[model samples]
Target: MHGSPTGGMPNQGAATHGLAALLLLADSRLPAGGHAHSGGAEEACRAGLITGADDLSRFLRGRLATAGRVAAALAWSACSASASWELLDAEADARIASPAQRQASRTQGRLLVRTARRIWPSATLNDLAKALPEGSHHPIALGVAAQAAGCTPDQAAMAAAYTSVTGAATAAVRLLGLDPVTVHRVLAELPYDSVIAEQHDWSALPAHAAPALDLLAEQHLRTEVRLFVS
Candidate 1:
């Protein structure tokens, strides 16, 4: 299955180079619609909960532990079994309580799948497109994309977990006028790698909840003026 998906052996060198593929999928400039969303950092900032780098670090850690963990697990699961993507989509929807968050996930998922189709066309992705025309949740699409890109499940999980912070870290630079360099430094110092290490069991995906974040998302949607979509 690691090969061309036609029962042929994959190139050894290319398989070993999966790290590069993972990076490309995880990069912020992949045109996957991640840039348009803040993963709730924007709302938290406006609510006076996040004022600077210190607060951002705490927020990122909490997010990594809860929402990020669930996303990474779903991404890894999708890569492990692309056929079960529909069930995984249901699980993602069940995990997300807020309607706004669910919409944001589907929106980002649609964009990522569309972009991935041009770069790494595959029957799996095409089937996914047909099955979930509105688009699967973001992590589900990301996992399938990782599979198409020849990445392992663990690599996909790491990419998913990393984006949980990097997206918000970038947003903080814009919203708070925080020093980009220092914000990145804060990102570098976070224990995201540890979180990824603990996410090996796709079947036992964490269902941790952040009610405050859910409330914030609802509040963000109601706000008259906002910069980010979610």
Candidate 2:
């Protein structure tokens, strides 16, 4: 549903402009608690799996390949605006392995939903309120929020991909003590093509393949000196 970032064509309807949707997706104070979790990016940094400017591309590419599945699912679902939250939540929950990570997503998701309901009141957002549990997962909340904001699944997917990559890079710098410039450079190089998403379906994806991020995520959870939540 997202339109051109620079607004729509001359005399085109405002709905075609994606500036508002982009702001909503990019806003950091949306109460999603995204600032907390690193999506295992921190653990990778500590394990020496990621390093200076040379490693940025590979690191982000790997991360996107893994975590991008969840993002694709939620974003595609968002376009419908009438998706089943419970089903989608369960689908996303199945993707989650560690108990700590599952809880973290739920905590953030619920908080994000609450924030959305308050800041930008709407029927679709309220519908989500009545549909989901008190504590849904992050992707589930994001799906509903994206729908309410009039963003299509592809647009949602791009936002999700970018967000995951950014969250991990942020965590890497803090946890592994990596240089900020290097982190930003790698972040910038990460491929974020929305065109490759296709039809977004991971129902048959093997857990170990599309989501190897759990290895670092679980490891990070066991560490006593970690900075990020997960």
Candidate 3:
């Protein structure tokens, strides 16, 4: 029999391990309380901003370019940073203009942290929980979780970018009953590469504003009846 790279054992590359971690972190099935929030899709749907697949596509594209880019940069920064959780949380606060959006981010962050700590059990995640008793931003928690799972900064960024719009896309399917295949096609076309760029400076993370989304979030908070949390 032919011997493998490591003395007859199958070789497992770091990329393969990272890919698994990335998929788990990005999966909607994770008990991270992500199912409750729509990433502003509920509001957008009620506001008639996303009436169909084409409108949803445009909305998701815009979100991917703006909020998704910011989230990817923040997650990459957090994954790369060893002890800058507090600073990163503050930076997230500054970048999120809407109070409603900020609340949603922190809510998701706290839930993600709770789930990640139980699953990964890393000192980094512990420090993150300690640093922000209130809760770190969602992207920050995601980055730390990725690190604990043996994922690289790039994988963290990709996961962050992926989630930024996926929740909303799923929400749209529920809200408007749009074709799942068509919605997924839109998701497949997202320019993830453009959002998941390398960022060396944590302080200079992308702050692409989504005023419409922000307004939608604020409006959603005020609505008496809603299907999703945000």
Candidate 4:
């Protein structure tokens, strides 16, 4: 029995490996559908709100601290809970400002799931897929999926923070006519953890979700033509 594989003690070594795996999956460039969404920076560019990499970084970080942080918090909440996907989804919808913006979220969620499934095979992910009703929002999906991936709340928040920054920077290149490398470097200066850590507390997230960033998303949505999701 000394070397037998079957045991109920819970494998610490395997658990460590799992956490490491989660870290990789949570990486921003895991080929997820993030490339399809600009997290509202597209609208900022079209509105001339951000004219350069410096402006893009400021806009991106601002959005991240507000709306992006909220979404990340919801995701973390769902992950830390008993699979309350619907509750989180509703929260995301309620926080969003416009129809088109909401539509973009739902679209991106489905796309992200498709990408996550191929990259990180998980029964929880499959279960969530079956559990989702039509038009589940992206942030909700991200929260549930991050749970399935065994990612920590902090890790999920960082992923989201980086996603917002990268999305805006990428969109700035396309819209404001900036250099992608310069954009990347500009965004790199962002202290995402310091920003995202505001949601590190489980109890404080809901209060933090409503903010000027949400107002910005709402205003951007009213524009006729746009280049990204808010």
Candidate 5:
């Protein structure tokens, strides 16, 4: 009888625990500072890029394919390589082109670490905190937190991919006054399965840069009266 990966639990028990953890981490109300930033959706909306649900859908899909893909890959890599936090962080830093986006990522990561530490204490989490005194990239923190919560690398990637659009989608609903049901339906129909597929090379991560998103983030940073932090 072999032990399951989740603290030697049975297969079913481990699966259940992993699912619970995944839901917990994926929840938007986890006090991870995700609500404060709109993942650039606010700026896009203000820039007339996302005026309604249809525009929001396009924005989300593009975001999912670019930034979302990169984030999923990074989270997957981080979950698999606990000891390579520094390298992974560097990779994340390199992928993000905008200074505003970088600051937002670290801010979210810092909040997530603070919250996850109380929920799932582990040496890995402590090591991550020490390695990046300021904070890690959000996906890196998410990957590590997923591992601490008994989730697999694939699960971590899925969580990362899902969040990449969800926050923006939510923001669109608030910013444009779009129908929440319509927004949610668009989210449900996103091509997440294809984006978060398994990757072989952790060193060669996907660098799908969203130049528009980068520009939007920079523009958002300069706006004096903005709704989101990013």
Candidate 6:
């Protein structure tokens, strides 16, 4: 039974393989529909709230503390309990007040699942597809995908936090024509490890509110001319 043909535990290299899987999910080029959404950066810019690197830094930091933290918590919960997809999906809906934001999340979630199915097949993901035919929320879908990829809940949470800021950071670079290096330096300096460390359970998901961010999403939807979708 040392090397049984009947699917035994993974080899010692599995941890290294899991780290690679985690990086793949965190990568911006994963075809998860992330490019189209600015996480509200475009709207903030249009309102003159985020004109330069300084404003961008403040905006991204606020987002990371509020929405980003919430996403990481939900993703941690979902990855930790793959059977609770429905519950987590409802929770995501309840957390997001704005209609535009909800639509944006579902759109991204749908795209993530579409790509994840091809990359990392799993019964949980298939079930999620059936549960929300349109799509589960992005964080929930991401959590399930992370579990399938053999990542721990903490790793999933970290990825959630990382993507939350990086998406907006990249969008700022494109919309403002700011020096990409400087913008990235700002991103590189974020206290992500501390933020991730604070996320311990679903109950403490840090629902810090930023009403301006929600309002920005609403206004961004009405803009007659804009670059990013949300």
Lowest lDDT 10-mer window, candidate 1? 2-11
lDDT of 4 by residue, 60-98 (tens): 767766766666666656555545556566667777765
TM-scores for all candidates?
0.92, 0.80, 0.94, 0.76, 0.96, 0.92
Instruction: Write one digit per residue (lDDT tens) for candidate 1, span 63-166.
Output: 88888888888887887775766777888888999898899889999989999888888888898898899989998899888988888888888888888788
Cα deviation in Å at residue 212, candidate 1? 1.5
Report lDDT (Cα) of residue 20, candidate 2: 69
Compose the digit string of candidate 3's lDDT tens values, residues 75-171.
9988887796888899999999999999999999999999998887788888899999888999999998888876888999999999999999999
RMSD of 3: 4.7
List candidate 3 stretches off by more than 4 Å: 1-13
RMSD of each: 2.2, 4.0, 4.7, 5.0, 2.1, 3.4
> Tens-digit lDDT track for model 6 on 155-223?
888888898899898998998899999998999988776656434455555566668879999999999
Residue 139, candidate 2: how far off, in angstroms? 2.1
Which of candidates 5 and 6 is the stronger one according to lDDT? 5
Model 4 — TM-score against the truth? 0.76
Best-performing candidate as measured by lDDT: 3
lDDT (Cα, 0-100) at 104 in candidate 1: 88
Which portions of model 1 miss their true places by more than 4 Å? 3-12, 197-203
Q: Which pairs of residues collide in model 1?
A: none
Which parts of model 6 are misplaced by more than 4 Å? 1-11, 197-204
Candidate no. 1 TM-score = 0.92
The segments of candidate 2 whose C-alpha lies over 4 angstroms from its true place after superposition are 1-13, 176-179, 194-211
Q: Which of 2 and 5 is ahead in lDDT?
A: 5
Displacement of residue 5 (Cα, Å) in model 4 is: 16
Query: Could you say which candidate leads in TM-score?
Result: 5
TM-score, predicted candidate 6 vs. hidden true structure = 0.92
Where does the lowest 10-residue lDDT sum fall in candidate 6?
Answer: 1-10
Q: Whole-model lDDT, candidate 1?
A: 0.83
